[model samples]
Target: MTSPLYGQMMEVPLLASSLLSHASRHFGDIEIVSRRIEGDIHRYTYRDCEKRAKQLAQALIALGVEQGERIGTLAWNGYRHLECYYGVPGMGAVCHTINPRLFPDQIAFIIDHANDSYVFFDMTFWQLVENIAPLCPNVKGWIALGDEGCMAQFRADMSVPVQSYETLIGAQDGDFEWPELDERQAPILCYTSGTTGNPKGALYSHRSTVLHAYAAALPDAMSASSSDAILPVVPMFHVNAWGIPHAAPLAGAKLVLPGKDLDGKSLYDLMEAEGVTFSAGVPTVWLGLLSYMKSEGVRFSTLKRTVIGGSACPPAMLRMFEDEYGVDVIHAWGMTEMSPLGPLARLNHRQKQRPLEDQRRSLEKQGHTLFGVDMKVVGEDGRDLPWDGKSFGNLHVRGHCVIDRYFRREELPLVDGWFPTGDVATIDADGFMQITDRSKDVIKSGGEWISSIDLENIAVSHPQVAEAVCIACAHPKWTERPLIVAVLKPGATVTREELLAHFQGKVAKWWIPDDVVFATELPHTATGKLQKVRLREAYRDYVLPGAVESDA
Candidate 1:
C-alpha cells in the first residue's frame, strides 16, 4: 500500500531559539538597541543578546523551571524582556507575557490560572507586583528586571521573596545549549484583552511561532531585512509584540525597543536616535506620534513603514502618513487566537496597478492573506459566502499558525476546520478581505446591518474630530439607530450640527447617525481598542432624538 508520492526531506524541528542563534552567528555586530527603563540608551549586538539569552536559560533552570512550566513576565518592550522571549522557551518552558495595563485582580487571576512558577518584572511595576502578590498563589517568587540598585525599593515594597535580574543572571554561565524539543510544544502563552470576563490564553507552539516569524518577516509581510532597523512600539505582552521578537532576529534586522515611553516625542526621539527604518503599533500610539509631528513641524529621518493594527487604522490616518509624510502604513488585522497575525495589508504588484482611487480603497482592506494562511467568510446557513465583494459574513481562518484550541479549555473553538474570528467581513474578487465590524458590535437597524466601523471611519475624517466611536442607540421606529460618540481635537469648535452634517452623502442616508454627542475622552481597553461594550452600558438609558419625541 506504500506509494512513492511522498518525497522525504530533512525533518528538523523549528524552534524560536534558532532565530536568535542564526542572527548571532551571521549578523553578530548588528545592534539590538533599547531605551532602558533607567532613562538611558542601551545598545548590544545580536551576539550579546544570544549570550545573555543563554545565561537567562541557565538562571531559569537554576530556579527549578521544568519543561512545560509557565514563567510569567510583567514588563515592557526592553532588552531584559527580549531575553525572556528567547531564553524561557529555549529550555522548553512557556513564556507567558502578562500585560501590565490589566487590572490588578485580572493579573492575579491569570497568574493563578496559569500556575506560573515565577514572574520577572520591571522595577517600575514593583508596586503592581506588591498589590497582586497576595492573590497569585502559584507564583513562588518575583524577580525585578533591573540591577542591584532596584533591590532596595523591591525589598521595601514587596514582602515576597524577590531578587534583582542582574544578580540572578550574574551567577549563571552563558555556556548552556538550547534543547531540541518537539516543534508542537508550546513556547509562548498570550491572553486576550478579556473585556467581557477573564482573559483566555492562547498557547503558541514552537512550530507556529517559528512559522509566524517567517511570514511576518516576508517581503510582502513586515518586509524585515538585515538592512532595516525596526522599532516595535507595540509591547511584547501584546501577542508577542505581533511576532517581532522572533521575526526581527529571524530576518537579521536591527531591533529598537522603546522601553515604556510611548508618547509621541519619546517615540520620535528614539526613532531618530536609533535611525529606526520601520515600526508597528496600535492606532492610538500612532495618533500621538502624528499629532506631535504636526504640532512641532518635525519629521522622521530614517523611519519608512509602520504596521498599524490591534484595532482598525482610520483611513484618514493612513492617508496622513502616506500623503503628508513618506512613511508607508501597512494596515494589518488579527486576533490573539491567530498568533496575532492574519492578513497583513501589504500590497502586491497587480493590486498596485489599479486606479489610484481603487488602489487606496484596496489598501484600507486587510491585505490579501499571506502564503500559509487561508480565509473564508460564511453566512448564517453555515455555507461559504461569495467573494463578489458585496456579501458580508462571519470571518474564519485556518492556517499553519492558527490555534487548535485555547490553553486549558476543553472546547475546540474551530468550526469544521477553520477558526471563527468573531468578525463580520467581506472578501472581494481579487481576494482583499475587509472587516466590516465585530459580530457583537454591528448595528441592526430596521432589519438591516449598519457598520459601526464604517461610520466611525467617516466621522473621524472631519477636521475637528480627533477620535470617533459609533454605537447603536435605541430607536422607536427602526428598533436601533446609529449614534456617534466623538472626541473633538483640542480647541475644536465643531458643533453637533456641523459634525453630523459632515457625514452626509458619505454613507447610506440611514447609516448616518441620528445624533452626535461630543465627549472629552472615551474609555479604552488595556490593548488600546475602543471600549464599545462600556459605551453601550453608559448610554443604554439615554434616549435618541427620534425616540425622545415618540416617548414623550
Candidate 2:
C-alpha cells in the first residue's frame, strides 16, 4: 500500500535471507543430519547450518568471489550441499548445479555455458573433476567439499589453486555480513533434460524461487511442517530438489540428506534412522525401494507418504505402497518451466469419502492447478476445448512462475504469456487434469491420436507384464502406429494374443497396439522417465502383420 507498484512487487526478502532468517529466529534447534564418509552420521541443527553458511560466505569473500559470478557445484544431497544452496545465493552469486549423470560432453557444455568462475566438488566426483577441468576456461579455483584426505589427488590434478572445504571453513572468521540482493536477481539456473532437442536453461529469480517454495509447502502440495523430517529422494540438480531445501526451512521441517548413495538399502536406512515421514522422487526409486523392502524384510517405521512425479507411476506400484506398506503415494505432474511443482494429485473434500479404488483412480490424475496457475486446452485451430474429460487437446499453461524464454535462445517458441507444455491432456468435470501423452510421443493412426501412456498402462495392468513402452513405428497404410514393447515379470508369460485380448473391452478396437514385442527392459531417461524417443528410434522399421513397407 505504500506505493502504486508495491502490489506488483511482493517485497519478500531474498531466498537466502528468508532461509537464514527462519533458521535463526524460529527453528534453530531443528536437526539437519547427513551420512558421512565413515559408516556413521554427522548431525547438525538449523542453527549450526546457518552459522556454517555464514562462514562459507566469509570464505568465499576471502577467496575473491565477486557478486553475480557463477559458482558451480557437483555434490550429492548432504548438509554441505545445503550450505552452498544458501551461501552462494546469500553472497549475490548464482548457484550452478552440475548434474553428475550427464554425459561428459554435455557436462562440459553446461560448465562453459554458465561461464562459472569457481567449482566445488564432493569426494565422489574427483575423477570427473579431472576430466572437465581443462574445458572450463573461466574457472580459477577448485574447492574440495569434503575432508582433508579426499582433497589430496584433487589438489594435485587441478592446474589452479585448490582448497579443502573443511580447512576453508575452519580458516574463516564467520563474521561476514549478508549482501543486499534485489529480489529479481537470478538465484539459480536449471537446464531441462535434452531429450527432444538441445538442453535449454531456465533462470530463476530469488523472488520467484521463494514464492515457489511457499506454494510448495501448502497443504495441497508437499504439505511440509516443522515437526516433519523431510527426505527428498529427488536430486538437488533437478528443479532445486523440487524446491524442498528452500521450503523445508521456511516451514521449519527437519531435513535429511542421503548423500551420494541412493541405493535401496541406503535410502531406507537413512529414512528409518532419521524418522523421515514424507519424501518425493520419480517412480523408479520407489520401485527399487519396494523391491528391496520385500527382499530384505525392511519396513519404514516413519515414512508414510511419497510424492511421485517426472513420470506416471504404475498403478500397481501405487497400490503396493498404499495397500501393502500403508504408505500414501500421490502422483504429481509439472515441467522445469513451471518451477517444477505445478499440480498436486489430491482428492477434494467431496471425493474423500469415495471407495478406496475410486479414490485411487482420482489420485492418478495430475490433479487440479495450484493457486496462481491457469491451464487451458487448445485444439488444432488454437481454440479452447471444454473440460469434458473426453475432449483431449494440447495443454497451454500461463503463470507468474512459468518460463517465457530459454536462457539464451530468444528464438524458441512462445505464444503470448502462455507456454505450450507440449503435453496433451484432458480435464474432467471435477477439474482434475490427466495427461494423455507428450505431443511428440503420441501415436497417430488413421488420423486419430493414440496415447502411448494409455496403451502402456493397459499393458502393464496384465499380470504378466513388468513394464511396457509404446512407441510409434512407421506404418505403410496407417502412416504411423504404436508397437507395444513389454517386459514380463519373473515367471510370468503372456503372448501377444492374450495381451491384445485384454484391451478388447478396455479401449476402442482401433486403439489396440498393432504389434506386441517382448523385451527384458525398457530404456529410461537420465531422470528415470521412460525413454520413448529411444524406443521409437530402435523400432523405426517395425513390421506389423498384414502390412507392407513402402519405398516412398
* Highest-scoring model, TM-score: 1
Stretches > 4 Å off in candidate 1: 1-8, 550-552
Candidates' TM-scores? 0.98, 0.94
Candidate 1 on 320-353: residue-level lDDT in tens? Answer: 9999998899989988988888887766788888
- Per-residue lDDT of 246-339 in model 2, one digit per residue for the tens? 9999999999888777889889989998899999999878867887898898777998798999998777778888888899887888888888
Give each model's whole-structure lDDT.
0.91, 0.83
Pairs with backbone N, CA or C atoms under 3 Å apart (clashes), candidate 1: none
